[model samples]
Target: MSVLQPEVNITAGLQYQGSQEKALVGVLCTGTSCSFLYINSVLLFTLRSKPVFCETSRYILLYNLLFADTAHMVTNVLLFLLAALKIIIAYIPCCVLVLLSGFTDIISPLTLAVMSVERYVAVCHPLRHSAIFTTRSTGTAIALVWAYNFIYILVQVFMLLYVLTKIYIDLHLYDFCSKEAIFSAPIFTKFQQTYHVTVFFAASVTIMVSYIGVAIVAKSASTDRASARKALQTLLLHLIQLSLILTSTFFTTIIAAYATVGRLTLIRVYNVCFVCLNILPRCLSALIYGIKDQNIRPVFMKYLFCQGRSSVILNKK
Candidate 1:
């Protein structure tokens, strides 16, 4: 999983100075994950509760993005907890978790790329936007994104199994389950690096082109200037979000570069990077669309605050 593939020896940081420190770190990580999960769940519910959100192409895409992020976050936190507690599982189960983590990790940026193009169309080709991105078409795009990642993961699985069958190795892991530990073959490592670089490059180009297109439309007098401006802002956010998501693919490589530093310093740096690059990015979708979007804000707040059925009925009336 891209989330678990921090290029450094992850077990090094898992070894805390004391039990108290370990417990504190686990609590902090778990608490943060739980909070984000709650917000994402509520926002997902909000997206589903209304017909407007249901029929809107962008909202459907947003739901897909949030779902992928939530799944990735859950698997990531599970792996972290397992490492922290020194729990060792069988080889097959670890492979399942690792592959699942990788799938969810890769899907977000692809979904963002599609969302960017959707926005570009909305701003630059307003007349065709509705026809171009109906709910069915939006769903098909999402399915294609998922299918692409699924095929990639399926290839990795076949390669891993082939390697295992040819080699003499223990069925149980000697260390914490991670991509590096499980898929340790030189070929697997090289393939993953190449794949991540390719995907990141492609997503980057898609988003940049979309941003430039929207910016051009915003400057044109014939365009809906207000809508174009809003899209430009949204695309800018997508770029930031994309950078954060893709940065995680290199978390291990970045940390490994500094591996020669003192143990205490490295631990601190690893913890900070893990939280910033891995955990926090998964929650930004909720913050960006759940809170920032005007259309979703009222309904989101009503559910978030536990407004009663009476309030909803009154508002609808």
Candidate 2:
């Protein structure tokens, strides 16, 4: 019956593939990642080395935000850039690494939101602020925010793998968070039919509400012109943060739409904005921090000029 032995080995021929250009791109991206690494490293180094803030709550908050940014930059930005460069490694599934990176990325924004709320309370609700957002409470709140974020993203990763394997059973592809493969997965399809879009919309709504809640709570408690003015500035800072995240969110959603809708017109625009979004925060934070943080301004200027002059000399060397 098996005389001629009709046999095919698909697995034998299927090879994991990428190109030299991809490796080069990954290297270039790795280099870019290193550049930020140096800058952020210096920033954090300075943060730790300096006695920049003494007995100041605002300084503490700035330092906290810096930590969030640093975490996001190190974890998310690095993984993403690596993934873009396609550096698959042993002992780690690319998907898991990528998911963890995404999870930490979410933590950055969530932490920022918490920081904004804390600041709003300190400025706007100065009376109950200590009781609510005391050091312990603030620490707890940050812990919970991070815990929830990781768990939530883990669920997404789980759903992407399991739900799709059960449903689509066809497109057994792994790029779940990708715009192209999102709805194509069977589990994602079921998720879409069930609560996917609803939950996404809900999250967006919550971020909006969080902003408004902070604004109202701050404004309602303002008793004088100066207090009201302080409330507004704090609110504006939060709004700027919100705007930064919102604009990036806009780019992500728009790119997703283009992927889903096949809108070629927007591909370039979305990609451009996405790159800007990735780099803008680091630069913008420096600018905002320089303005809001008096201690950092002079130090930053000295470093900027000193570093510039050194580079000029090095080029001659």
Candidate 3:
């Protein structure tokens, strides 16, 4: 029988900071997941009650976004829990979760871009909005997004598996499997870096163009000021969410690419961004888009009260 020995090179200060940051990030991620799921659940229940809500194209897109974000946050929470508890999930399952998280990361941006386009069309072509973005068409677009993300991620996973055999059955080292690990992986090729850059840039351009088109159309739509205003609010939230996540991703990539980790300052900075900024977007999204939505708020309130009453009864018993 044999045991694989390990080495620990990180200093005590850095280790403390890293653990603290991970714990904070895990707490934030849990909050984001709970809030997002609660609001989406209530909103979904409300949508089910009203046939009109189910029939709207924008609502359909929103539903897809909610689902994608929930999955993304759940994977994040799982990763954080595993790290926090020092639990060694089998290598295969851990890798699968990591891939799922990456897939949703791509899906979030794609969904945001599609949402921006939907708003652009609605604002720019009010008369044709229904004909252009029907319920069926919106559903098909969402399906295509999922299909593309699945195929792309699956291919990348296969490529990585083919190139890096060491990672196949190894234990999940927190320092190695954490956010910083991606940059150091031997199999994280130039092609993968290019893919991320391309996705970010393309999604950014799409969002910008859509926002500009919507603004231009809004300028002339004096009668439809309300719809235009709502669209702008939604777009603003999406942009904020996109900026937060992209900024964290970019900073981590830059640190990994150019900076040396021997410097404690650089490592700490990378850890901070990785833990804090990385998970903030979903939390903000739940607040800005889900909680603040006029239609969803009432349903959420009802759900909250019902839960409160149920808890009170349980406590009394």
Candidate 4:
């Protein structure tokens, strides 16, 4: 493949200093495992329950989000392991991983966008929400989201393959395989930039608009005080999660910008930031949204720890 082809010169790049790379690998491993376990526990609990605790539209979105987040975390672990071990990965596995990672990256924000819309409908059209967002419809929506992401990944892969067939681009430009490495080719860089901007823009607009609408509707009704509060909390969580994800993406991109300078100290700082930002949000999302959810928490406690069910705190509708 073109990525590992002989003509593509591998640069001897200097980045992380002693113990820095090791620390990153360790953090990634621990974070990935922790996230996997937590998410798996929630998933299993949901499965084992005679009737799932929260099977609404919002819960469905959250269920899918958990799986997507786990996949994203796993890809990060693989990338970090390759970087730490100094493995010269071949083109096929590298492309597959990068595509998988990128696909999940986009899916996350999109899933959140859908969740925001679900909240909007629940708040703005409570009577019709049930009619519109039935089990079959919600399942179809989630399937559509995955379908859209798969097409996005295929388009990206097609572009890369076409460009590689025509021109010789080096994979060695990046210490780890990422979609950003495509930026090395001027043609692909435009597509990468355009795609990133489009996704971020669309997701941002959907989230902001939907949440604002939900908040407005919730606050308008005196009886919806509890819902208003939950909306606020949910909005904060989504923003926090988005900030962490965007920070990781840009942190990696910015570090690549300074790659030519190859400053060990700079790389070390970014490595720490990258690992923390990437891992913390995954764990926190599970804690804040999954374990802390009023309905889900009781199920989790009962199933995982044999603890008695706690009172549900939020609006179940």
Candidate 5:
């Protein structure tokens, strides 16, 4: 959602200079997104093709996380493309895009929190981990995450409708469509800020508590030291991932702070922040779990390099 606003502004400045820079930046952004998309797609296939991955509760949650991240990347790239192209969309379509983007944005951190708790349970309650995180319960948890976001989107929709009914505006947007542009009402802004703060706070607390619990269990003599250490490392990775995702939500505020520094400086900073905060966070899961996880790394590498048959043979052995 922050993509459109900064992109539109940046694109406008590029237009003043020439079309080449705009096109170059567009290609760069799109190509980067496509590369990550391909990597995520392959990782998804790897997760699905293996029976072991499909059957495990942790892997199931990982698939959910990757799917959400991929969807988020796609939505963001689409929004960026729209802004870069200077395409003006009608209000309703724009709303749908924004809502989808917001939904995807919220899901990742929540999923990370769930994954953290799963790791905690595995470490602290090893005997009950299997019983507690059964396939059915895992599915239910994912469903609840989606359902919660759906309800949040519905609330935004109602707020939008209420605002529309109260005021009259052109259906066609003059500026590039964005959540801020469409839902510019003070009430909507306040509500979004409050909702984001609450959700993030809850997720942060969940992840922190889970990490603490896992760390405590890791030190206990009764626990399997190796397993406890692994779980603790996983939880730390989750915290890092959560931190990246959380930083992305502050994109607008960061941009705002840099506004008075001149357009050129702003553009340079924006591009840096966009890649680091927005693009990188979406793809970090693949790098983190895809490469760092020993079980996933081999299969991921095989599929990544298009050696699927060979990977199957190895797995069979």
Candidate 6:
């Protein structure tokens, strides 16, 4: 990640606080399609109740990660596929795109916080662990995460599109995976930029700090402090993965904001490269979860690769 000079062509778009532009393409990018399917398939095999040993809480965390990653993938596929299909269809409204892309982008940090909460309960209140981590409770927690994230996205999206649409008027077609879609509305676009920066910063930092609080609680607990430490390590690793994967997306959105003002040359290359890079982590999320969770890796091997045939084939007399 070397520093590149800002394109001279970009105009008033530079007023955006940071990299908060057309980051939508990061979700709409095509490179991650196959990986999403593969990881999702593996998750089905490994996320069963039988293999989830109670000794370590990683199993629970891994299960949550599966949903998050699968969702992240599905949403990505939808966004990109729609972008491509729009070539054959008529005008697709920016508001619809705004809502879809906003929810799709928040999956990374939201799942991280879910894992942290699971670890917190498992470690902090061992007596009530089973009661709290029940199948019903787990489902409730998951539903809340998805709902909250969506609501958060929805509110801001309306704000972003509405404000930007009112102020500026940039009627142009911006192409990503699909043919250039017309954005003939600048005020709406600025609204989008403003909404993106606010949510991006707030969600990312809040989720991260939540995990840190979980880590602190885990450190104070008496039993399974070791597991707590392990969980924290995994959380840190996941956070790092998120930052790396999101690098391009964050930059691309910034580019989009500028490109709206018609600064479209050297910056476009940066946009393309970063947008493509988003898939690397998204597709690899399953592997990251497996690596982070000891229980998950063995289960993945047992079912996915069908290893450990020796125990079944030969009983040593």
Best by lDDT: 1
Better of 2 and 6 by lDDT: 6
- Indicate whether candidate 2 or candidate 4 has the larger lDDT: 4
User: TM-score of every model?
Assistant: 0.89, 0.61, 0.76, 0.79, 0.88, 0.61
RMSD of each: 7.8, 9.9, 6.8, 9.2, 6.9, 10.2
Cα-based lDDT for every prediction: 0.86, 0.54, 0.69, 0.69, 0.85, 0.56
| lDDT value, residue 293 of candidate 4 | 78
Runs in model 4 lying further than 4 Å from the true structure: 1-50, 169-176, 180-183, 260-263, 302-317
Model 3 scores worst on lDDT over the 10 consecutive residues at 1-10
Model 6, 10: alpha-carbon shift in Å?
31
Residues 1-317 of candidate 3 have per-residue lDDT tens digits of: 13322223346656888778767755765675566567656655555666766888877777777677767767776776665566765555666787888788777778888989989888878789899899889989999999988887888777766656755534555443443344246456565667777877887888888877777777883638788878887887788778776775575556666476565556456445545665556556545654677876665566655774687789999
- Whole-model lDDT for model 3 versus the true structure? 0.69
Return whichever of 1 and 2 wins on TM-score.
1
lDDT of candidate 4 over 1-317, digit per residue (tens): 87765444443222233456657655766566665556655654563474553467777777777777777877877776676566767666788887888788767777877777787777778789899888789899889889988887888778788888988866544465555554356766566567667877787788888777877776674537787678767876786687677666665567667767755556565557556766566555566764667777766556555343332323332
Rank ordering of all candidates by TM-score, starting from the highest = 1, 5, 4, 3, 6, 2
Per-residue CA lDDT of candidate 6, range 51-163, in tens? 44432354655566566656655655665565444533333354455355456566655666566566656655668878877766666766786787777766665655675
Candidate 3 all-Cα RMSD? 6.8
Q: lDDT for model 2, on a 0 to 1 scale? A: 0.54
Worst 10-residue stretch by lDDT in candidate 4?
308-317
Ranking by lDDT: 1, 5, 3, 4, 6, 2
Task: Tell me the spans in candidate 1 whose CA falls farther than 4 Å from its real position.
Answer: 1-17, 255-267, 308-317
Give the worst 10-residue stretch by lDDT in candidate 5. Answer: 17-26
Expressed as tens digits, the lDDT of each residue in 96-173 for candidate 2 is 554554554455455555655666566556688768765566667667867876676767768776755666444334
Task: Name model 6 segments beyond 4 Å from true.
Answer: 1-32, 49-64, 75-88, 93-98, 152-225, 245-251, 257-277, 306-317
